[model samples]
Target: MSDPHLTPNWSTSALLTIDVQRDFLSEAPYGVPGTTEVLPALARLTAAFRTARRPIVRLYRRDGQDADLVRRTLLAGGAAIVAPGSAGSAVAADLLPPGAPPLDPDLLLAGRPQPLGEHEVALFKPRWGAFYRTELDELLRGWGVDTVVVAGCNFPNCPRATLVEASERDYRVVLAEDAVSGLHDIGRAEVTGIGVGLRSVQDITASLTFQEVS
Candidate 1:
């Protein structure tokens, strides 16, 4: 008894990755544990989307005065947690295409998206959800996207918020489970409860390749 609405429509799908900045990767300040381990799979999904000529959007956090209470405290205490224009605030190198311009922190913080590749762009998420105070929803709508394949650094915060909000907005949402970090059994059950279909990196890339062939 599969949920028809939950099935992935890859042809109309876009990939949205949340909070994959270097500051969230290993060996960086305030890096989330387990974020470093999932890079390979995340990279594969990114590359596959590029090859498929589908839209890819990278959402990163650039903490500022508008940052959340916890982060604001850290920022006030002299923490350079993804500080604007810092190398540590840029997307993880491997997660981006080669020669992609460094992220424009000013542009992002001002609520504008910066081009990353021909079919890809990066934007800043001021809060946990990508759609909050950002152009993400409008961008996807203008591109005629109704399905979003989500992956990235952590599941509990940004990824989870993005998925739930995507569902709330009536997009068919699929989680590249193996391509995101901070996931556990309960989290899996939770996402499924919200009708987020889960797939591995292999499944997503293979499905895209199959679509291309057919």
Candidate 2:
């Protein structure tokens, strides 16, 4: 905990990508800015975690009855927001496991995680934080994950909130700085102020490879 460089231990880390769904992509109608630009790097991180046989958790935003006020209002106004079973609700294809199961919006809304691949899952988050009313913390603990590596869309929202929650739960957290969208200087500084380690996509993947080999 003394050194940011020494903080991340990949052996016990879980990779969590938030709000990387199709609808949140930069090209989509309701896209989050910078999401598309980060996809390539984010894909690398996912592939690294998959190859390392670590837990990979993918989070999507589904604007349903339980959605946050802004999203609920948008939904009520006929704005289709990551509608369950809709193509737009699915995670971005580049980051998904090969032959990953489709995003089960209903199950996620009901607070159940959908299996994606071995040691991987896709869950829906009703709010900015992944752990809020979700099984994310339980799942990580069950997987023996003591460290969390987070990346994806809307850093100031979901990713940031999840980082703070992970810290509160006493899990070492790493933010893949270049792999997340909507990031700003203050947001980066704020997370680190709470003991979050900020690393690059290359840095995180390098750690994974090192752990995998020796």
TM-score against native, each model: 0.96, 0.96
RMSD of each: 1.2, 1.6
What is the TM-score (0 to 1) of candidate 1? 0.96
Query: Which pairs of residues have clashing backbones in candidate 2?
Result: none
Each candidate's lDDT (Cα)?
Answer: 0.89, 0.89
lDDT of 2 by residue, 78-190 (tens): 99878888999878877877788777766877889899899899877778998988899999989888999999998989999999899989889999999999999999888
lDDT of 2: 0.89
lDDT by residue (47-145, candidate 1, tens digit) is 999999899999988787889887788788888888888888877867787788887877888889899888899988889988889999999999898
Q: Model 1: C-alpha RMSD to truth?
A: 1.2
